[model samples]
Target: MPDLVIALDVGGSSVKSGVVQADHTVYQRRTTPIDSSGPAESILATLAAIIDGHARTLGKDAVLRGVGLGFPGPFDYAQGVCYIHGVAKYEALYGLHMDAELRARLAWGPKPPIRFRNDAEAAIIGEFCYGAGRSFVRGIGVTLGTGFGSTFVVEGKPQRAGPGVPPNGWLYAESWQGQQADDVFSARGLQARLAAAFGRPLDIPTAAQRARVGDQQLQEVFRRFGADLGAFLYPYARAFDAHVVLILGGIAHAMDLFETAVAQALRLPVRGGALGPDAALLGAAELFFA
Candidate 1:
């Protein structure tokens, strides 16, 4: 019988789940929209349904191995408890013991082990194990999207403290130029710069499109963002003696727009993630495999 694990990347607005084989290939995958702000029970029910659906798809002889999740913070990944509040998402889950709730709802013959990891950490782990960071011994992964997410990895394991890593290995709370790194490096940051430049707010996708079409002003905005990102990462990269940096998330799609500036400033190899959204799911599965 084949052994398969269910892996999930839980986000504020959606959940990406997959059935992964021992070889790290996803046999089946799904992305489900979630109203994270909804009632806790409703959200839990949705998650249960997703899991049950995947379980039903397995062949009769397949053995369920475990369930793994990549969730955002402030969460207790080790305990499967949620402390996320005031984030406009997953508020109803505050103080909830997710592992117990999930276990109670599963219909499998024997409950599978359930584990969780920080979403950013999971992404980096996926990269380290299977994607762009596969060749490096130590590196940093940055996910630039609705917010700035970061993690440090050594030998395929996520590290929270050491030389060059900020408290909790997170850069979002760190200050750069009197502003939180999240405020300066996220999608909102790009929009803020674009708004300041054109006297109106412009979304990242629109800005990228314009920049690609020879909109010099928009192009400059991305370049400046890249330069600033590089400047911010320089100290940490040097401190950690990082060998490489892997960029992930929606913003990474536009890396070409700013790759030059980041490379020039950081003076290190910067590469985009090769796994796309699957990185987190694969990384989540690693909680059990590792």
Candidate 2:
């Protein structure tokens, strides 16, 4: 029987879970809401259910080895404590011993090691080992979603954030055009830019649709965003000696509008993620194996 792990990729909007084998093959997968607005315990319960539901599918022969999870941070990844506060997302989870509580709720027959990593970190590892980054020995990954998430990896190990890379491998805090990168690189940021340009608000999906139809304003927004992304990553990539970049997250679906600009500005190969959206889930499982 193959060794298996229950893995989760927790995002601001949803939780993606799966039973995965050591070779990065998923046996079963599921997704549920994160319910960030709910009580902290409720959010933990949702994660527990997702893990339990998937583990049950393994049956008696399954050699369950561990549980792995990847989620947003500004939190203590080592301590499993949530520190993301006053941001209207996961704020209810502050000061909670998130890892211990999650372990207590999960009903595995024999408890396994539970490990956590910043969601973007896990996603990049997944890409490095199994996706568009597999061909590269050194690379960077950027996930365009609620925030501008990024990671730098070399020889299959994640590089820590330093002089050029901001904290936790994130590039959102860097200064650009006299403004913080977060002010121009996220979902809300894009919408705000669109509102300022078009005199109306447009949601991310709608804005992406508009960009696809030759809406010059929207197209320019993404183009600029892509260019900003390239500018933000240039120094970090050079510092890390990254050879390729893998773009992930829901925003990657609209790469057609911005990829060229990103590639042109970065002067490196930029490609959409190849693992679909499950890269984080697989990477979470890899944490145990690592």
Candidate 3:
């Protein structure tokens, strides 16, 4: 196995890339927010620059095995195609052959293979391999960030999209509380809910801060978030027969506010992400080994 690989976790808000060792140590990590509103060519150019810059920094002596990428869906991983049309973000990637575009811009000796998977799937794989899900044979991973990301894994492999898993193995579009899960479980959802309840604009951090200070309204928001999360995952947990459900990403930091509700709603074990955001990058790299 190669000692190092370039890994990228592409989210709706930002793209995180790094050179990661087999043991999960990261080097030369870089993160930048993506402009989903920008022109498609510009987005592609930004991605190209990052990949080229990383490859150059790794130097000619670096023996990189391949590049592994975890990106949002819906996408065609086999053909390196993106289908993010009408989504909240990354819509410019729609119908683009992203893998070829990146590879064309990467100037490295002996072009390496590039593997792609849904960001949620990669995150879960990372969790199973090195985080809270490590001990469980059946696990479900959810990343509550710009959007809801989800995947089911069993015995170290991700389950394909099916009856229980939903389309493209994504939980974001799942129906919940008479609306889509994406409408209730994402960063936008949190902010929107806060605005409606408090009659003002409130970002996630401010809401969390207020909750910490015993602000009842803010506290209720998080509690509702927790309750909704629990309600959303209840069926999935039953379907996957999950031993543990790992919650990850920016929203996870407020677990103290909503942990009780989530725990009560979930029958199985539930925990915050042990590896945090790095889990997806690490998991993306693992694809090379697999």
Candidate 4:
């Protein structure tokens, strides 16, 4: 019988999961909506259902290896406890022992081990092992979405501290143009720029659509964003002696608009994620495999 593991990438809006074989083949990928603002019990039930569903699909003959999750922070990944407060998501789970709570709700005869890692860190590791960062010995993985997420990797291992790495290996809290890096380099930041340009509120998706049709003003917004992001990453890249920069997340889909600016500013190889949304899922599986 083949051993199977469940890998999950838990976000504020949804949970992405997959079943993995021992050889790292991922299948049965699913995205389920979740209300992170709901009660802790509800959240746990949702997660349990996902796990149970996957377990059943594998049938009685399959060996349940373990479960792994890539979750957001500020969390105790080592302890499987939630400390994410004042973040407007998962507040109900604060201080709760997630691993225990989840185990209690599961129906497995012998509950498999559950492990966790920071989502951003997991995504980077996924890319390092199988995607863009595989070609580089040292690299930075940046996810540009609702917020800015980052991780530094050296020789396929995540580095939280060292020369050129910021506190916690996070770039979101860093100052950029008198504001936090997240305030200037995220989806909201792009929307804000678009709004300022047109003197009206604009969403990122709409702006991206316009830019694709040769809207010069909208195109300029993305270009500026790229330049700013490049400037923001420059010092750290130099300090860490990184060989490449891998961009992931929803915003990365607009790379064509800003790729040149980022390359020109950073003077390093900049590439978009090759694995798309699967990077984090595979990264989560690494907890069991690695």
Provide the RMSD of all predictions against the true structure, rounded to 1 decimal.
1.1, 1.9, 2.4, 1.4
- CA lDDT scores, all candidates in order: 0.90, 0.81, 0.82, 0.89
| Candidate 4, superposed: residue stretches over 4 Å from native | 59-61
lDDT for model 3 comes to 0.82
Model 3 lowest lDDT segment of ten: 160-169
Off by over 4 Å in 1: none
Q: Positional deviation of 4 in candidate 1, in angstroms?
A: 1.9
- Judge candidate 2 against the unseen true structure and give its global Cα lDDT, from 0 to 1: 0.81
lDDT of 4 by residue, 250-281 (tens): 88878989999998889999998878677898
For model 1 the local lDDT of residue 144 reads 93
Clashes counted in candidate 1 amount to 0
Predicted structure with the largest lDDT when compared to the true one:
1
Better-scoring candidate (lDDT), 2 or 4? 4
The residue-by-residue lDDT of candidate 3 on 1-290, one tens digit each, is: 43788888886667899988877787888897777668888787777776777888776566788889998778898788999888667787788888787777666656677889888778889888888888999878888887788888887688876546776567887788788888889899888999999998988988899899999988998998898898789888887678888888788888899888887898777888888677888899988866
Candidate 1 C-alpha error for residue 190, in Å? 1.1
* lDDT for residue 259 in candidate 2, whole number 0-100: 90
lDDT of 4: 0.89
lDDT of 1 by residue, 97-201 (tens): 999998898876567788889898888899999999999999999999888999999999888899999988999999999999999999888889999987887
Question: In model 4, what is the error at residue 98, expressed in angstroms?
Answer: 0.7
Error of 2 at 222 (Å): 2.4
